[model samples]
Target: MAVNLDKPQRWKEDVARSVDMYNQWFLNFAPGAFRATRISATVSVEASLLATSYLRDIRPETMKKNPSILSMLRMATCPPIAVDRLIGLAGVNSSLVKAMEKDNRLPVRVTGDLLDKELQKIGEIIERMADPDIFVWLARGDEPRQEEIHRAATIVADRLCGAQANPIIRNEQEKRQLAKIKTWLEARGYNEAETKARVDFQNMEPGTFSFRLNVKVRDNTVNIPVDAVIMPITANKGDLPVLIEAKSAGDFTNTNKRRKEEATKMAQLKQSYGDNVNFVLFLCGYFDSGYLGYEAAEGIDWIWEHRIDDMAELGL
Candidate 1:
């Protein structure tokens, strides 16, 4: 469940609370990056873009007066994972309405065109991740946490899913529009392809890789439908690159647990694929709010969590 820190007063309190949790939990030099993240997480472009100045001492807005290098890690927007979650609701009730109407597809309130301008708006926002200007604002912090980036994505998703902005349509033209816009905007998970999966274990991507590992055993069954993981990064041998499962903002500091759990799977993976397959888990969230209670699994060597609230932090 997402925390309700939509208001300014509540946002400050949330950031302060998160800072305390991290400073105490890690017991290391956390720096003020987390606080900066907290501040960014609460900012809304709708409000921030127009507001000439913010209240003094406000958590995120206060940076305007006493900005520091650490605060640059903050994300100016929400993460992509969260935005996808929000899109889950696109065109919701269409099926039920179609059934009631005894028709296969439901007609749209905004007819004429196959796609709605509002629906395309979401695709546009998702595209902004690759937009040089937008991403620079999001990844402003130093070493911005992946979890924090995911939080920003989630917020963006929620905004898109909101009734005021988001609407669902099943028209082919609309779907095509979404796909084109999503691809252009660099929307998170847009890299994922949906298809009827086959059950096989030949290491083929299109087929579902069944059988359980030590890490995700309980959650997965012996024979489960799996989606092909599109390569998010280009790789060459000896480049020190390995795949990591990414997470969104929501008690992500539990990455400690994620790391430990991934360790179990990593060992099994190594046994099958050789130690050449290094193990790591990516917690995709904003770093500022701290890993939303997520922790890297115990004994995990390297974990690379990435939050794409903007491209600046990635130095892109």
Candidate 2:
């Protein structure tokens, strides 16, 4: 599909309109929107019940078998330093730590007496969780005490539901974007099989060279995965072999560094592939005001900017 050069300006205008609308809503009615509702109403009651039952028996064995229980508790606790210490003290498997690291959810690092103090706090919380009085209050829906229990239960339920639902949501979104891009390309006479989704550069060119962008390690090279790639039909095809990198950022506050890193990657890709390959960066969802300018300055070949719902109109 051809790049829509005018779309980025249109997207900026759309973003401004959305921001104005959200600002108006927030000023008028967004605050205290859910203050009147109970925490239990915000989450599944059945899931909270299940979590309560599981939390009652939170031994090392049970924790290892049901890591989600620990995950929920960790989510409920502020900072979660105590939870991390407790997990380490409980001697849970290395997989939990690895998963935490992968998700960027690892708690603060502490050692010696400080860690012991945190563990003590975590143990007290665990004791409270296991107490029969709390469970009784939770079951009876008692006021005040029940509110505390309900808040904890809702936190667990929210974390568990998010863990289960986020992957499905992201995958569906990726698939939808891919389908739209593929259809747009096919309409313009590109072969269906030529456009592939989830293409890893390692599979395409293994060990020939590494594309390092803002990466700090010498031997820790990773394969960059393109969301969608259009392969060249012939060796002399000048207009083919386009690499598309699509990213949807749900929040812009924490995305500045990531977007800069992406710009570095785009520059690195252009440097590595030179004029033989084309690189397109497709951005959707939230972005900072200066993001497009930064991407352009980084030497990206093309950028198709639109909202998440406007993916079909990206390259039209």
The number of the candidate with the highest TM-score is 2
Q: For each candidate, C-alpha RMSD in Å?
A: 21.0, 9.0
Model 1 TM-score (2 dp): 0.26
Over 1-316, each residue of candidate 2 has an lDDT whose tens digit, in order, gives 4343334666567556545543453345323333222243335433534544534433433333433444555544343434456556555434445444345332346444554454344435664544344344434544335565575566555554455453444454455556666665556555543233433342332111111112212243534556666543332323334567765455566456676776656655555555444566665455556665566556553443333334333332
Q: How far in Å is the alpha carbon of 59 misplaced in model 1?
A: 54
Tens digits of per-residue lDDT, candidate 1, 1-316, equal 1112122344334445544543353334222333333344345432332231211112322222222211121222234223233245333223322332233232345332332333333334333433233334333534324454445444433343332221121122223323432343244332333344442233323211111212222324422221112222333333332233432223335443444454566565555556555343322222332232223222233221211232212111
Clashing pairs in 2: none
User: Cα lDDT of all candidates, in order?
Assistant: 0.32, 0.47
Q: Which stretches in model 1 have alpha-carbon errors above 4 Å?
A: 1-194, 199-228, 231-242, 286-316
